[model samples]
Target chain A: MMDFALKTFGLTKSFSGKIVLDNVNLNVRKGDIYGFIGKNGAGKTTLIKIVAGLLKPTAGSLELFSSSDLNKQRTRIGTIIENPSLYPNFTAKENLRVQCKLLGVSDEKVIDKLLDIVGLSDTGRKKAKKFSLGMKQRLSIAMALVGDPEFLILDEPINGLDPTGIKDVRDLIAKLNSEYNKTILISCHLLGELAKIASCYGVINEGKLVKEITASELEEACKECLCIKVDNIEKACDILENKINITNYESINEDTINIYGDFPNSASINSELLSAGVGVNSIIKKDKDVEAYFIDLMEGKTND
Target chain B: MINLLKADLYKLFKNKSFYICLVLSILFSYMGTMINFAYNSFSNAQSMYSLLQMPELNGIYMFKTSFRGGMLFYSIFIAIFIASEFSWQTIKNIVSRGFSREKIYISKLISCSLVSIIITFSYVLVAVLYATIKSGFGKLPSHFVLNLIRMILLECLVVISITSLFVMVVFLIKGIAGSVATNLLINFFSGDLIVLGITLLLEKMFKKDVDVNKYWMFSYNNIFASFSLSNDVVFRGIVVCVLSLVVFTAIGIISFKKRDI
Candidate 1:
C-alpha cells in the first residue's frame, strides 16, 4: 500500500447555511508535491484550513500520516495558510525564533541556517513589516521549515511574487522536497509555476474536487496537437484518416478537429486538407498547457 | 502548554505596546501620589492644587489611586496583546502546529492574567513606594503581613476575572478596532452606566430596592481598595470572581473553537 501523507473522506464545510466545501475527498501521497488548484471561493483554502486545524469540518474527517489522531499527527506537519503567520514588529530571525519556541526547536543554529536557506540572512535588524513582500514570503517559508516537518502545506506561497521571487520560492520548494525528503501540498494561482514543481495535482471547482491527476497523466492529457477548422467535416475526417493515416484525432465540434500525434507541422496538415478539395479555414499548432487544461476543466468542456 | 506559554511570554516581553501600557499606568500612578501630596498640603488654599482635584483627591487612597485608572490601561493592554494574535494571524502558527485549541486558550488566559497582575501590582508598587517617601507606611493593622497577603490574593482573583472578561471580548470581536473599542466601552461603562441601568430597570420591575452590588465585579472592585474584607465580603468576592472567570473563559473558548480561522 502507498503511504499517504494526508487524506480526507467526504469532508464538508458550510458557513452560515452556505456550503463552502461539498463532500470533498483529497489524497496526497508521501514525498510528492501536490498542487491544489481552484478559483476564488473554490474551497481550496477552506480545505487547507481544516487540515491545519484552524477550522473544524462541519462533517466527515481527515487523517494525517494515515492516523486518525490528527492532534498528535499534526505535530509532524507544517503549514502556511493565507498570509504568512508572522509578528510584524519582529525581525525575520525573531519571528522564526518564536516559531522555534512554539515547535520546541531548541537549536539556535537552525535559525541562521533557515535564514540562509530562504536567502534572508542579510535582512538583519529589518523588521518583518519593513521587509518586502517577497522577503515576507521567504521568511514565512523559513518559519514553516523550522522543525523540519515531514508534511508541508503552503496555501498560495507565491501569490504576488515577482519573476525572480517566484523562481526563488519555486527553487526553495523543490529543494525542500528533494533534499529534505518532504511531502508538500501547495495551492497557487500561477498554474504554470506550479506545473514546474508539482508532481501531482488536485483540481477543485464549485466546492467539489473535479479530478486528481499525476504529472505524466496531465502531460498526456495536455499533449501538443494540431487544431484545424474546416467547412467540410466528413470529408476532412476521411481525408485525414485515409490520406494522412493519422488516426489519433478528436472532433471538438462540427467544424473543428484536433489531431494529436507525431504528425507533420500545421502547414502539412493544412496543405493536405486543401489538396483534398476540403475548405480549411485555419490550421494552427496548439500546445495545451496547464493553464489551458485548467480553463477547460473550469468551463466543464472536458468530459473527465 | 509549557512551550506555548514560553512563546507567549516571549511575545509579552517583546511587544512594545505592553511597555507603553506599563509606562502609562506607572505615570498615572505617580500622578495620583503627586495629587495626594498636593491635596494634603493645599486643600483650602487657592493655587495650582485647586485645579488638580479629580473626584476628590483626599486621603492617601493608594490602592484606589493606582488601581482604578490603571485598570483602564490593562484594558488596552489585554485587547492589543490578545486580539492582535487574531488580526495578525500569528495564532495560526501555534494552532496549525497541532496544539489543541483548549491548550492555546488556557495558555493565553494564564499569560494575560499573569501580565494583568504584573501591570496592576506595578501600579500599586509605584504608589506604595512613592507614598512611603512622601508620607511613611501608615499605621500597621494587626497581623499586617498576613492581612496584606490575603488582600493581595483577593485582588489577584479580581484582576484575573477582569482580564478573562477582556479576553472574552477580544475573542468574540476578534478584530483590533472592534475589540479595543468594546474593551474601552466596557471598562468605562460597566461599573457605572451598565450597572446603573440594570439597577434602575430591576427596581422599576420588581417595585422594591435590590442591591446588585454584591453580584457585579465592579462592585467588588470598589470595595477591594479598603485593604481588608470581612468574611462575608471575601466570600462574595471569591464567588463573583470565580463565577466571572468561569463564564468569561467558557465564552472565550467556545467563541474561539466555533469560529473559522
Candidate 2:
C-alpha cells in the first residue's frame, strides 16, 4: 500500500440512481503504466472522472498515497479526464502557463519544458482550438505534467489518434514511466498498443472491475501451445503420453494434439512423429495477443 | 485560492471574447451617454424660462445613470466569461487540481466581480467625461466631493451584490444559454415582483402604508439612480446589498460543491 500510487476500496458511483462504477477495487503502483480497459460505456470514464475529482462516488473510498488529506495528496497527481479540458483560445504555451499558475509553480522554465516534452514547443501563438486532435492530446499531456506531479491519470489518451500519433504517445508514456519514473494510469481502447507500454492492466465490464493482472500474469495465461495434426490419432496420442512422457499435452481433436510444455521443438516433434507410424500433417503454435486475451477476459472466457 | 484567481485572470486576459465584450461595453456606455446628453439638452430647452427648476446635467447625475440598464451588460459579461469555464469544460481542469470546490467558486466570483466592476467604473468614467464637457460638474447637496465619495462607496456594495447575483445564477444554471436566459429574466422580472408582493402583503396584514422597495437592493438601486440620497436609505441599501451578496455566494458555493462537473 505504501508503494501504491492509487488504491480504491469498493469505490462506487452512480448517475440518476444508475450505478456506473460498481464496487471497483483497483491498485496502481508507483512507476507503473497501468492500462484501464473497458468497452464504450463500460464505466471507464466514470471511474476516471471519480478519481480525477470530476465526479463524486456514491459509495466507498479511494486513497491517493495512503494520505488522510485527499486534496493535499491530489496535488501530487494530475489528470486529463474525458476530453482534454483546455482553454480553446489560448496557445499551447499559454495553456501550460495557466496550468502552472493553478499548480502554483513559480518557475517559467517548467512551461517551456512541458511544451518541449509534448512536442508543442514550436506551436507559438496558435490557439488551441486550431490544433488537431493529436496536438490537443499532446498538449493535454503537457498540461497534466505541470507541477511535476508524481502520478498522472490519462483517460482514453489515445482515443482518436492516427497510428503514428498513437506510437508517439505510446513512446512518450513509456519514456515518462521509465525515464522520469512517473506513475501513469492510462485508459485506452487500443489494447494492442497498451500491451506494448503498460506494466499491468485492469479490465472493466458493465461497471465492474472484472480482472486486474500484470503483464507477466497475462503472458502466462495466454502462453503458446504447439498443436500438431497427425493421420493416426491413437498412435500420436500414445507416443505423446508414453514415449515423450509429456504429461501436460492434450489431444485437442481427433487428429490434432496440443503440446503444452516440455517439448523439445517442432522439428524434433515432427521427426519423432514421422518415426512413428503417424503421418504429421501440420505443426503450428498458437497464442492470444492482448486484444484476444482481453476479449476473452471480457466474455468470461480463458485463453485455453 | 490565489493560484486559482491568478490562473483565471491569465485566462481572462488571454481570451478574445473578454476584450471584445469590454470594448463593446465601453462603446455602448459612450453612446448611451451621448443619447442622455441630447435628451437632457432638450429638457433644458423646454425649461429655459423656469431657471429655478432646471435639471442638473452634472457628473454626479451622469455617474448615477450608469446604474440604470447597466445590469444587462453586466449579466452578459458574467455569462460570457463564467459560463465559458463550464462550456469549454475548463473548470474541470481546475477542479481536478487540489483546489476545493469552494475555492474554485470563490476564485471565479472574485475575478468576475473584479472585471465586471472595472467595466462598470469605466462606464461611470465615460459618463463623467460627457457630463464634464456639458456642465462644469455641478455641485449637489452642498458637499460636492464628500457626497460624491459617499455615493460611490454606498453604490459599490450594490454593484458587487448585482455581480454576485449574476455569478450565482450562472453557477446554478451551469451553462451559457440557461444562465444567460435566467439572468435576463431576473433582471426583467424579479425585484419589481418582490417589491409588489411585499407591498401587498404588508398592506393586507396591517392595513398600513409601507415602502418595501426602499429596502430592496434593485429597487434602492433604481432610487439611487436619480441621485436621490438620504442617510437612512444609504444605510439600508448597504446592509441589504451585503447580506444579498453573502446569501448569493453561499448558495452558489453550496450547489457547486455538491454538483458533478
What is candidate 2's TM-score against the reference?
0.88
Which pairs clash (backbone N, Cα, C closer than 3 Å) in model 2?
none
Give the C-alpha interface root-mean-square deviation per candidate.
0.8, 1.0
Residue-by-residue lDDT tens digits, candidate 2, A1-304: 2489889999999888998889999999888899999888889889888887878899989988876477888899889888888888888988888998888898999988888888888998999999999999999999999998999999988878999889888999999999889999999988889999999999999899999999988876667778788999899888877877777877767887777756677888788778987899999887766699898777767544
User: Could you tell me how far off, in angstroms, the CA of residue B62 lies in candidate 1 after the best superposition?
Assistant: 1.7
Per-residue C-alpha lDDT of model 2 across residues B105-205, encoded as one tens digit per residue: 88888888777777777778877887888775666656656766776766666778888999998998888989888888877765577779889999999
Tell me, per candidate, how large a share of the native contacts it keeps.
Answer: 0.97, 0.85
Best by DockQ: 2
Per-model TM values vs. the true structure: 0.87, 0.88
**Runs of candidate 2 exceeding 4 Å displacement:** A226-286, A302-304, B46-54, B140-143, B190-207, B222-231
